[model samples]
Target: MVSLVPSLTEAVAETLPGTLVGATDWCSHPADLDVTRVGGTKNPAVDRILALAPDLVIANEEENRAPDLDALRAGGVEVLVTVVRDVPQAFRELARVLTACGARSRPRWLDEAEETWSAPAPARPRTTVVVPIWRRPWMVLGGDTFAGDVLDRLGFENLYGTHPERYPRVPLQDLVDASPGLVVLPDEPYRFTAADGPEAFPGLSCALVSGRHLTWYGPSLAEAPRVLAEALRAVRR
Candidate 1:
């Protein structure tokens, strides 16, 4: 099998080991993963992937492009495209994809992740927050996104959660005008850092978070809540 999504690639590599014949360069987890590198998620080397002759290629609607997957399909490679918008959907789709890939049984980490997130959240006043994924044009997390759901479950309300666009590009002034209680910045997609993103939001709190834990749905799910909660706690203080 070949994986196009980094999270799913980690999932496959960790769960099935040598079954992953090829994976994109972005699949960085399980650091020692010694699979054939097909290239990046958005621009995979189709010819290299075709040469591997993988029976199945795993992809996500958000992380991969249609043309690339279609090209693989045209080459007679079966492609499984997954759509994960929330934690529940992530669990459900992971189960489906793993089963379809002939998993002997459910991975224990998946169950642990479910249990970890399923536990009741402490009742607290929800803090309205704006989570920025990118910064050049200033894009933020919006409605129906996994990160938004994760934060909502943790008693943090996304200020832009109702926006029509999934990751809406808004002006810096508009974000400031919204007057969110906090600004959450992740270290991927844009690499927002302590010295970088926080400067923009002056007095308001800004949380520097891990992009993998915030958005990935693999084994990272088990630790995401804790990792994110710690980050939020520090920012909230």
Candidate 2:
């Protein structure tokens, strides 16, 4: 199997080791993963992937480009494209993908991840938050996003959750004008840090979170709630 999505690569690698023969360069989890690199999520080397001749190629709608996937399909490779807009969809898709990979039973980690999100959230008022995934021209999590749903389940409301675009670019001044109660910054797609991102919002509280925990949907989902909640709490301290 080959995986174009990083999270899916981790999922398949953990569920059934030695199952993957090829994966994108961005597949970083399981740190010691040894597989043929097929370039990247957006621009996978189709020739390299075809040469690997994987039985299945796992990809996410958001992380991969359609043309690349089409090229793979045209090469007679079976492509399993997944759409995960929210947390529930993530679990459902993961299960489906694993089942397609020939798992006789659901993986234990997947079950644990489901249980983690199913538990009652600690009693805390929902704080309005703006999540920035990028800078230069600021971009934020808008509506129908897995990360936004994760935060919503954790007792936080995304300020731009009603926006039409999933990830929208807004001017810095406009983001500041929104006046969110807190700014949640994940360290991926842009690598926002304490010194870099927080200074943009002088008075607002900012939480520097793990991009993997905040955005990934594989084994990390099992620990994301605890990791993310601690990061949120740290800003309060």
- Judged by lDDT, which candidate is best? 2
Model 2 residue 141 CA deviation in Å: 0.2
Counting only residues 3 or more apart in sequence or on different chains, how many pairs clash (N, Cα, C under 3 Å) in candidate 2? 0
Q: Can you list the residue pairs that collide in candidate 2?
A: none
Please, what are the lDDT tens digits per residue for candidate 1 over residues 121-172? Answer: 6698889999999988999998889889999988899999999999999999
Superpose all Cα atoms of candidate 2 onto the true structure and report the RMSD in Å to 1 decimal: 1.2
Candidate 2 lDDT, tens digit per residue, 12-68?
A: 999999999999898997799999999989899999999998899999999999999
> Each candidate's root-mean-square deviation in Å?
1.2, 1.2
Worst 10 residues of 1 by lDDT: 228-237
lDDT of 2 at 16: 93
In model 1, which runs have C-alpha deviations exceeding 4 angstroms? Answer: none
Question: Which residue pairs show backbone clashes in model 1?
Answer: none
Location of the lowest summed lDDT over 10 successive residues in candidate 2: 228-237
